[model samples]
Target chain A: MTQSPSAAMESLSVALGERTYPIHIGAGLLDDPGCLLPYLAGRQVMIVTNATVAPHYLDRLRHTLSGADLEVCEVILPDGEATKTLASVERIWDALLAAGFNRRCTLVALGGGVIGDMAGYAAASYQRGVAFIQVPTTLLAQVDSSVGGKTGVNHPRGKNMIGAFWQPRAVLIDTQTLATLPERELSAGLAEVIKYGLIWDAAFLDWLEREMPALRALDAAAIRHAIRRSCEIKAEIVAEDETEQGVRALLNLGHTFGHAIEAHQGYGNWLHGEAVGAGMAMAAALSAERGWLTGAEVERIGAVLAAAGLPRVAPAAMGVDDFLERMRLDKKNLDSRLRLILLEALGRAAIHDDTDPAMLERLIERFPRA
Target chain B: MTQSPSAAMESLSVALGERTYPIHIGAGLLDDPGCLLPYLAGRQVMIVTNATVAPHYLDRLRHTLSGADLEVCEVILPDGEATKTLASVERIWDALLAAGFNRRCTLVALGGGVIGDMAGYAAASYQRGVAFIQVPTTLLAQVDSSVGGKTGVNHPRGKNMIGAFWQPRAVLIDTQTLATLPERELSAGLAEVIKYGLIWDAAFLDWLEREMPALRALDAAAIRHAIRRSCEIKAEIVAEDETEQGVRALLNLGHTFGHAIEAHQGYGNWLHGEAVGAGMAMAAALSAERGWLTGAEVERIGAVLAAAGLPRVAPAAMGVDDFLERMRLDKKNLDSRLRLILLEALGRAAIHDDTDPAMLERLIERFPRA
Candidate 1:
């Protein structure tokens, strides 16, 4: 059942002027060295993955790369959100130097969001910048984080508090990788898939509603459509605002609350997608209260997250004060004032700087605890 | 004497399209709060300096900052090129997070080149990028590194081996700070001043040939002219090639050879410009052998370096083999072939990719041993 690499593959370009690159989406991209070779800066390629991911696909990837006349180096890191740190990036830097990698070398990020972030940041800072390709193996990465150039690692105080906005040479997304993903990881990734529908495309949201069961079942066509639409929405936003100066903030609709959730629970306790799912529910509820969305619309949002097996409520341990404390540390906050992206409608989102503190507190208090 | 901030100051802009910034060169700029306040992203400013620099200028800089409605945070680092490592950058990251600095916060680099490089890198990566101001205190910084967007730290493998092209919001160059600089440091700064003449302007070179005594005497008008001209040449080149893609590399005339000398002697042993001074001599010799410049022209280059108190010879300890080994690690090399910026004639330079190893070895062998 070996699928040809070029068979029915789709390519979407991220038009970022000189840094523009293509997103190649297909079922068997990993088997095709040509897909990765063309984007490399030189004959030397460094693959950065994690311990968890390496045991599953590293050898296969290595075997594929062996066909090309390129020098390949591998740096496998400990896996998890908790492992994302400056120390981790330093290790990669050390490895690159030890391997004699120069500016001409390219780094291939071969795992989920954490690996992509660390590898991308490594490329951004190594020798003051080098070329890197994203071979995102997780659904969450395929749909959102890997598409946009927002690469970074988390801090003790906040998530993704340290990093750079370095775009990749290309992103290779193989839907077949989803077959090996853990059930929770699959559901967590769906949170972001659902988010694209919630924030930018209402009609896409309607499609998600009808195809919820099929998406959960990992139906080929349904999942591919979900990932493609999500990437299209993300690519469009990222193209316009590469540095998150303006419209790019719309992409963080649930991320403000979600980052707080992940930080409070401690990174890796609740997957990023799960926290984002519940966070989006909170955002929807707040938008409804602000008269931007209907109460029924809020309920619909929660119902989808529930069907997607994502949490629609906050952890019982996290009280209103805890959420406030964590959210204040968000990068979006200015002068200690919380700024968040709120939905004006299901398909429309905007940055809100005037969120009332008292109202926000009450809103956090009212979220279904635990 | 309390000098009026606007009494007599020079401002030059480094045009980098949208990321263009101004380099304000003058005396007593540390006493001027208005020049710094306008470029700050927010009221919070983190001043990153080194121990050697702090004792001389920190309080004065802090006092001026206090005049504005700003929250000032200071992180004093150990002084020396050896302190420029990822570990130092990590410590700064910790202090920043503990201080609750957000994306809106600005990092003000208030020391020499090492300080500017590290602090600028911190700004580039912190919270996925934040605004930074470069308040370069050394002659080398005010004229060269501070004006360019090259920000980085040294790896155990090479100098400036890890960094980014993070542009500053503005660069504040206070010539008054140079009064406190050491004699050796002043001479080291002259190397870069001489570099402007060697790579771009023959008239400037002739001027240096005549005014070398006045320039070394630290005559105010002469020194200011040297600094301004150096920055002007750097700004023009940087504007044309912001990322070192083409002609901008001419600025690294002596850097490739110089970096090898610095790394071989251990960083901070030979000041950056001293290494560049000797490195420039090596490049001059090589160009002469290639029939691009006369051997007499080579002697003139060496005489100017000698007059400026810069080393006109490489370390006798480093053999041709050692130089070749270290030079191979340079970022400019492609496909393991050494690509050097060599002089086609005095004040005119070009990138030389067709250098023969045997001829290069002979050139290195011919260099007078120290």
Candidate 2:
């Protein structure tokens, strides 16, 4: 990101074959949604938001979209990961339909991961795939969830267990939303920021290591660069493998292991990004054990995540063996064959097939002590 | 159709780019599940059916799929358009997750329109688009619902208001299932069968007008041919326009008026095909009123549906003005713009856009005394 990596700006594309969409990263994006007005159907617009971020910037978004032949319908759901369920989706769907939304209606989701995930799924299933504009209101959503078209409700059995790969028409990330997010939430969001650096951009990791203090302070420029770089990396991967057939799986670097921690602890108990933070540590540990990474690379991963206030060590109560068992249910498994995404150093992540269950068990044994 | 007009089997392709699927039509084809086995993931199978269809042919299907890792989870939802709701979908989602189904699972919908619609939607949203096999057991589903990939539950405000364009991995129609269908249900199914002929396949409508008596007596060969021909025609139209862009709306020849009747009557009061039967008569009346058709064309539509034991007329209690208001909330409406599929003559339908609302009201008057 030296020299701003093209101050001209970078745009990424999520290739879903016919449902493909673009992710624009830059300043002043929220001020202009004109680039996405083509997909906006009808004159009526409904922006579904949450409790936390509504006070800060809902008015700004309202003003931006005021030009469209649309009536804004805003229904603020409780703000949290726990709110991503079928119940929340029902409210959004009912409000839209009861308010006289037709097929040509567009729903704009504004907020963090939960809001984006829930709102995107609502749009996907609402009347069977209405147009949804992503107004992702958190670093977690903008850098990660908002870019991918994987929209759905979390099942009791697991997170994102029930969802569709429905692409959003557009995603608007106002960096200003970060000012209101708590430091803890912001730290959790950074785990994803660090994920892009670790999985596919070693240089980005180095940059993160250098800018850790500034990012920790919620420096706007540093945060914006991290999101832009993370999105560019993610969009490239998604476009190559939209349905998670190949490169897409690589995007799940620490996710398979991370999903385990999140589910075992109960979803909200372990913030997805925090769990991913810890899982990346476990993955680095396992990768080192497999000779996929050296001591220095593993340590660098730990250092970066910890510097961002993300959890680098496993939670004290997480039993290693229990963690391994939980991971078996991850969708990344093939015929119940556990597939783990391993880092081949800083700049690359490869999906390792036929992972040694015994090694996974060995890694689990070191859990509490980890 | 009487003379086997299917040159090269009348094939049409649904162009979804990569996720594209094929729709096949023929008689007594349900006995062959070989074409379906490739799309089935894992041996654990859940065949969702209704009580009505279970006693008819459930054993044969169970025996066929029993060869694989087919652990059948059969759910019997009540039969009727009224049964398509969220409660039923929840029942399905719970059953799938409770059974420890991961992404590697298959749901086979083996019943009529209600079962197919619900089961396909269950597959669509369950884990965000799982592979589903559609085995439509009724004429209405075989001809219409089973194709087009429209799967959804009805909302209190409207019918077929909640659904997705979640295409099935494969659709299987066992023409033999219609043998056990009640006379009224069979006649209702004919409303859709007659629909394909009136909208796009004019020659087929001519054939149905001739085959009405044989179909009324439940002639298996004629029933099978009608089902195949109607499906073939629908598949072609749907393949050309999967999402009702322009040509696809023509497929809803009677639905604009028909859906309103179903909603006003509180659904299930009149069978889907019955409402469609009367709705088609209303569409013809509208066409005549709009001067697009002559009295003879409207009379022919009324006579054909009436001879088939379809209502061929609307109920008088719900006045024309009230019916038009109900049509305003139609899912097909793009904003306040009305979309109606009308027949220029038997076997020739076109979407009439920007039609005068006052003219549509007068046409509804004829249905009261059809």
Candidate 3:
């Protein structure tokens, strides 16, 4: 299902009125600053990137953005999931304020999920929300975080503990940035890639299985197709349920359980996608135990995750009680009730609120150890 | 223009889908939590108020919201613009986290513009944006801050330095909250009420002049009508340019200059509305000097503000240089170029770029006071 280059890929728009943005997914799209320029609509531009990506592409992005009547203020931050806290968000806000950024100015977030989320959040909160463009450097962000319009800083209590659902005016995903992304980072991005298959697209799951090696090799066509499909599924879900009221909650397929694992180990202990990969496997197994998913289907989900170099087991000493307690704090939880999103079959999912706590405890006990 | 009590007033809805809320304004509506109940969706509630209002009406608000199964956790903060800082926002976040607030929970803000901004920011950032209701207690908040989709926490460097445009689920103007409000606070609110008239509605300005006495008397009918008109004017501007793109920028009216006065005096020296009252007089004088507004109009606007018990002059001995420096840090400034909203006529405003610094100096000199 991989599309050839110049295969007529188009852009999708997020409709938030004046804050609306187009998410472009295709080869060489990152090099396309013209697509992002129109959104600025003003003279000044300040880009917030990270240490890892700045060395590789900041100059290119700067050169592209440097035009008549524009002054670019770039702030390079340390790269990692642990960096998405108030300090980084505040630092960026400081830079913008120090640079005398005003209401009409734009803040460009040019990095991975953490970078984009923190930068977008800083922009969202700076002066009661400024215009920010998402220049997602990591595939994880290009597909999931960048397009969703969820921006925030993590609190001591939890990840993304503070933020706003501020939509971006434009998203630039340059495949060129992936050339510098480490293999481990690519694998982390794949967890979300595989998640699309595990939740609502069996055919895409089959395609990922067939294309795993080429994707592993970082084939441009394979990566492009994966990004587009993942974004399309996410965008559709967002359009239908922008606020996660109903169908959007289903999008958190393994997220509710996955969040607990991340919180238990601490935010940066387990990379987000790695944990999701393992959580999805656990969810699949739970579905199989409930007779909602076939054993064969569950095995197939594990196979793709394994092939993509993701974990299929939980932490060795993490207790079921601690996991349940953390899930209570998850954004998906309603009135402190643990709402679990379980797959009934490939390409189909359901939110199961009627699960017995004892039954969940028994199944959690059987989850494979590290 | 004052509407009678028991007169039907429409509930204005902000069109942000799930983020939408009805702005309930009328006599005795503050006691009616019914407009908020639907949006509460039966979720647990946390009442975030300030010291000034708590002793006055926390009991009434609690009784009104004391439906079965609605757990109320009240966090009372100090009253003043000084309390709108991150220190206060963090206190609120800490309180919410300690109380175990999840996404399903709602934050009810019951105070002046300061409390509304700080608590609304906590909601916007708390768990990446939760539902919040605004029960504006001060006249300034009722006529201005409560309507627009603006929320933020202050920084040591500036007012509303860190924040977002997270609109409330519902804005309850209990008209009754104003009864206990200090005369200073009421006069401060009148500054913004006058601002509405100066910016986009000359008729509103004329009406404010006519109703100044009743408003000063705290007539429930006068208060409700004034609040509703202000909301409608703000909502209309917000709709056309929600993020202050163009016409929305016009809504800044006296705010650009007023924010400077607040910061120059170190945030709390002058109540927000009083500075705005004085700032509006300055803006009108500037407009008149530029021939955009007639001298008669400027005099009329001044008389109204004076009648409202607002200052029409700047703090004496304040340097023009410090004033310009403070304005440079304002959200309205673009790369140090002050983007000011000036009057063309009553209710008609325009954004003026390339403002003469000399003119600002002279205006400050003429308005300097004790």
Candidate 4:
């Protein structure tokens, strides 16, 4: 399932006025210096990656950034969602300081979502921010995390409790890196692809249902199209609302429920995409409960998630109170009200902070469990 | 002398377009709820102060915020420049989460620069940017740190290595708080006050020279005028360059040399203003070395610092290389060049990055030592 080396690259910009940046999607972009060299803030570059991703892409990136007057260094951290802490970010800062890297230095995030997030935060706070470029290897990162400027680490009580809204100079998504992605992780990535369709485009949702098999089979064309379209929708939304002030919260259709699962199970046990998969289903069911979505539409969503090999049921051990408590700590909530993203219909979503507590409890109580 | 309780409150605005905020200077502002209540983003408020200042003003602040429907909480950190670390900021974040404070909550920083910096960073990162107000008690904070949007903690390698440019909703300067400040600390704060005069206004510098005794004696009118003028100059510069891209670097006239002294002596020992005082003298001497100022002008600068009871020499133990190594890591530097802000005359300062390394070494080697 190797992508053709000659596949043309697609470039799109996340328009944020003065902070606008490009998202470059192609096969073998990591091996091409042209994709990375222009975005380097200066001659100094620090590549931040993790153990799980280093053996595969670190050397390739180093080779691409080699030659010339560049002072390139690296900080290899431990892998997994559990390892996404401020301590790990500190390691990146330590390495940067040890190398005497200046504010002009550029940080290249060379792994999946965890690496991208930590590296982005390191860039955000390092000497009050330096330029950074994202080289996402995971499908989930390419389609979601890497595109948005949301960068931070998980706090013990709540996820992403400490972070800043720092955007990158560019996002270089080399689709070829997905060759080594695990099956579960690939399915996890599809959960977000399905999400964009559920929230923004019903037509794209139809395209996804027809193309899920090809997407799962690692068909290069299907994968590239999925990544590109996902990025486009995200860029459009981010352009409209760069800081999640209004329309952007619609992007978190399943995140409240998903974060609950992740926190309850400890971070690494349930993959973010897996939790998102089940969470989206729960959101769909709730939408149906509110009469905004039809029962058949909810069933359609569940089937597509199943086709993508994502969980469509909540973790059996999680009780209604477990979900409620974790969701209460969500960043989206204002004051006392529980703000949620609910679908009005396929491809359209809205924020609902007035959901009846008893009805929400009933929905969670009767929700199917795995 | 006690400031008249009926002294009229003077307010000015830091014009940053949509992010513009007001700065109020008066007597007994901490006890005035009308000053603090309007700036709160929501009903939730967290008061962040240090142990030393808490006993003096915490209860007064709590009382000011108590009567409303506000859910007010507080996190009192240990006092000292040494306590300005990420760990302390984490404690603030932890307190906010434990209290169930949401995105719309506001944080009120009530102490010196260290407390304001940590609390501001906490507000900046909590839920990815919450509202915060600055209630600076120390003279140095009132004149300098609280007015600027710069907030962060010091890393072992460098001061303010991790931070963000986060502005506050308002800055409340209670002139009466200075009544309880230690003489040594008051002198330390005057170092920054002298700085405002030296860097931007020669007439102000002359006025400071004449009024140093009144300022040191805590003349109610003299102290109030100095704080207001210093803040006015700082706010004008900050509004012109919020992120330190251009004119803002002039504000660091003596900071490069000062930071080296602080790092060598350890943070709390030298005090930031003391270091800056000596650093300003060093900058004046170097300006003479570069023919930008006459020897008489340089001597005048040193004499003024001494009049304010601030040091005019680097630490005796620090060698030439010790100064160079620490100053090289200063945030103002661009790439490999050591960017220094040096006096051009009695009041004007400019950044010079092409200073001869040998000349800088000789300046440090021959500079007076305490």
Candidate 5:
């Protein structure tokens, strides 16, 4: 809940009582052994990353871990959302088994959401469960996926159709990593940053509107503040509902439509945050239709998304039926009813399962396409 | 903890606070809707069984589940431990998704240990976890695997190498199902029954020694008592330590050696309980060698296993190196040291990681061959 006084790092705890872990955010945090070593469950550490990320940060991480009496090993996997499958996770398990890594061993996820999700799952199911650390190199992962314990691989039927809520021992977010992140990817990450504002804090939305250029420029201070705020909001939501029984559903304000978009386009075609950007715009529009928000409020939401360089319209190739078919299969749905997270206000979200089918159809039918 | 006064069934709870659920043991629990309906998370129910089990009990289970506003579906997998793989679980997930089942759905594992383990893992990861009910039909499942919530599948590298400690909503054990169990399978279940006595209760051991013939004969009252006591012991240990952090390791008294045998013999070749039976014998003999158990005490353990029709000797083809290699990869081992659950005295077990390799090697070398 407080910043680590010794360094420029800010630390927050996802308070799960016994499983409570720290999220450390700062530049050069990955270069500091102090941030990584203490959380290692044992001397056996398995670093799971992708070929793309491995070339950039794996050696630096290995160098930082050199002085310890640790038995460090790594499994570099192919890069892409398509690679986020059980087969890739099996490679991780194979590596752990080949290395004779035991229950006491810790798995370090050293890439983006795909690597973190797959690696975390590998930790969750390997020998039942083991300790894991998230070293998210991408901004999307740093502020979102890496902080929460939602770990899994894609099922052919759905995204994250199979996974476990297995938390990491620590999450180390190196803000410096964003320097190497593609501009489009940076814009994608900002989609989630904008989401935190739209769902939980209008004041943060105001700040983002004013600081959009600074954020887009990769301003050090602006990025740290954004990452810290996003993680704090996510941690608060997750802490209240670790298994998503209640309020956690509100965090998925755009995920239902977003997941449908991802599935329709085939995952990786549109980055997750990119789809979420458009999905959130759809949700805002729907919320306005439901009289929860004004037309002006929906326009304001669109402005922030545009400022962040995120898509503000649905893909032209997708149809209303495509949206309906995919959204119906969302994990959030219950008892055959479609559960949607709608904007109750600029900074607040609500779960609604009673949305009339005809109204939803009209909304999608009239909605603008890319 | 008490038997149901209204019916001929006995009931016990695995007290995990808010996650607590009951285990009902009786002659025909599968025919009683009351035993199951209350725990269904929602109207959606997916019965996961095997070809061997569906013909005998599927209709009966459906009949019991009928007359309610339930959307019931079933996935019948092929029989055998070989079917206990991620592919089987994927089929279960695919069915749930195809049925459009949601977070509130409950999975019913309606077969033996394999079904229970795979289905439980399915429930654990399906939509990040849903409620599941275990209706274990086999004796091995009813007495051991069903109650503990140790759900998983065997990895190509090892037995139960991938899994979770996801507790079930309830466990229903109908002793009548055992009537159809093969003689060898019945004997396999008895191995676990004898294990509880050896690890926790001398009196239960004495009673089992006297009641072996009656149990083998499937005498209704004798079978019920064994299942109940076994459930009770397992429940107590699980409540004390839900995960294998401490005291719970004792429940795996013979599992380390047993898993080695299971892995070496290729899972289904030597039934789980049969391997555990012989493993328990090896443990007793090793305990005697360590002066923690007397020769007569070891002999008594072997006699009880023999009476249960379980193997008392290691497989003839397995040498010392085979056992060592497999045992070293066991999940229970920590820090590159072999952690074994050994008998300190009859009815009491202890975790030991300091066993001399030469000593263990000699014990395995001298162990009697089948």
Candidate 6:
């Protein structure tokens, strides 16, 4: 938090075998064409964004890409999670084909996680795959979805129920975009930032505890440290396991329950990071009950999430039975057994599949809206 | 043709480094559940078939898969090249979600090329991909589409214009399924069988010339030989180039013109093989005009395709301009320059981007429908 915001750009690489890509993080990175031009293998590029994002940044992106050789197009989608559907993806497909985009074309996803997932999946499946780059705008996207190459859309039954593991050519995260982020979203994104500290770096948790005010106030130095460090932790885990065959599942700390909440609340009602914030609280409560974490450790984790203005309880209308039914549909479940990532301690997390249902029911009851 | 059909099944492996898979060709393979059970990594299996192929084999496949441990379901699509569309794929997505299919569910494609492509694409995108096995029932699929992991749906603008290069766990080709293939389809399948010979194997071309009668009659031994040899040739090329960067493009010898014909004729009017058959003739004519193949050699190749009842000329309604427009839309194109696969000589093919347009126009005019 002591350094200036524009000190120097940091680059991290996800070490997937052939699909390895770099994540570039800094302030005002988007102002430089050098950051984008090298990734374009061809002259045709399509920028995909949403109504909320296009007016703010699409013109600048177009200006940066205004070379005579480059033919750039944009497809603006409606903002929100509800818009991440097969029908919306089909619009992208039709737009690309109608514009005569082929395998040589590259799609640029320039918005939040929904746009990245939708555009990435479109790029993955378009003509058996084309090249794509990610310019993730939201904090949640910059640190999480944009890096791992997990691209997909939600099904009525579940979130991210249809997708492909297609990696982007590169992920360019310009932290300056956070200036335009809404307050609710800023706090929502902080939930994931807190998650990195909780799940992998206990020492970082202490840093966040001390600098909670700086982070909540959107101090550029504090934001940069949080994003770069969060990305580094994620990169190491992804390098170890790209496709979630093993250790990668640890990244889903609150996601299984988070996805259930998002789906139950009708997608756009609650932001993804918000649900995850609340869901992480429930997991912490459950972890304490399982004897993996002390009651004091759980409270410490809760205090940090609360400090970031995240929800401290689950929705009162959602009962344990609803979560149980929804969780059964989780992609991580093996056969019919539910698997969850829970805190083993303040900074360590482990995937557990043997939690007693009765105990889970009691844990849910504890998180009343009041 | 000398060996007994049931003596033993032949297995060929596609050497794609980490994505390598086995192609198993045998008589009565679907009759034995053992051939399929090992490939099922999970208990849930969804058989994607077509109306034409289901009545003949669905019950037998179900009976064979009648273990209490396995949960089997079917999504039967209308049987035709026209059925390969984004709309059809949506039906598959909805069906899988409704049935509670997740990442572990294995999709078995149980019909012809259309079903295999549609179902394979479904498996590729369903929850970011799941394990899928190919049980190709058509000779075209058994030898070509099923062996290579190219799965997709046709866009209204082009054939296979939307897809992903997702590999299957294994491919099972049952020679007995050819017994139910219509005469026209059996002849159409021979077009691709002839392609392997024309593009790579001169001696196999000679063998196909000798066995043309037996193959047309659906003789079991001849069918088995043709499928095995075709699969072998395809496996070798695919092993060399899985994603068609260089050597794999050689496999699309007649496909550029063929795809144009398929697209121009509205996808189902002429079978894929029939269009390819005619397209190959056009390619041979173009190759000879370019002084690559002898005029006599061109006629020899034409006579073999003619022997299989393949059309000798492009449809009269399609003018040279129509062929040019459609071929420009081929996946092989780089930017807007057209690249095509042409014969250097019998059993040897090369990708050519410098074909003289005037010469191509003259060649098209030679193929009058009358």
> What is the DockQ score, from 0 to 1, of model 2?
0.69
What DockQ results do all the predictions give, each relative to the true complex? 0.81, 0.69, 0.65, 0.77, 0.82, 0.79
In order, what lDDT does every prediction score?
0.90, 0.79, 0.81, 0.93, 0.93, 0.88
TM-score of 4: 0.98
Residue-wise lDDT of candidate 3 within A1-370, one digit each (tens)? 8554334446777665545567876665555556667888477788889888888888888877766468789899998878888888889878877777777788899888998898888877888877888889887898898987888877778777787777888887777678888887788899898888877788998899999999889898888889888888988888776767788777777777788888888887888888888889888888888889888888888888889998889998788887788877787777877689899889888888877788888888878889
lDDT of 2 by residue, B1-370 (tens): 3433222232344556555666655555555556557768776577898888888778878876666666677777787777899889888988887776767788989898899989988988887778888888887787788887889999888887777888887776666677778889888888888888888777888899999999988786787688778767776777787777778887777887778888888889988888888888888887787778898877887888987889977876778766878888887787778888877777788776767877776667655753
TM-scores for the candidates: 0.97, 0.94, 0.92, 0.98, 0.98, 0.97
Considering just the first chain, candidate 1 attains a TM-score of 0.98
Candidate 2 TM-score, C-alpha based: 0.94
Candidates 2 and 5 compared: the better one by TM-score is: 5
Tens digits of per-residue lDDT, candidate 2, A227-268, equal 888888888888887777788887787888788888878888
What fraction of native interface contacts does model 2 preserve?
Answer: 0.74
- lDDT digits (tens) for residues B188-279 of candidate 4: 89988888888899999999999999999999899999999999999999999999988899999889999999999999999999999999
Off by over 4 Å in 1: A1-3, B1-3
Put down candidate 1 lDDT per residue, A73-177, tens digits, no spaces: 999999999999888998899899898888889999999999999999999999989999999999999998898888989878789998999999999998888
Q: Which pairs, if any, clash in model 4?
A: none
Greater-TM-score candidate between 4 and 6: 4
What shift in Å separates residue B250 of candidate 1 from its native position after superposition?
A: 1.6
Chain B TM-score for the candidates in order:
0.98, 0.92, 0.94, 0.98, 0.98, 0.97
Q: What is the C-alpha RMSD of each candidate to the true structure, in Å?
A: 1.7, 3.6, 3.6, 1.9, 2.4, 2.3
Top-scoring candidate (DockQ): 5
Among all windows of 10 consecutive residues in model 6 chain B, the one with the lowest summed lDDT is: B1-10
In model 2, the runs with Cα more than 4 Å from the true position are A1-10, A15-18, A33-39, A368-370, B1-17, B20-29
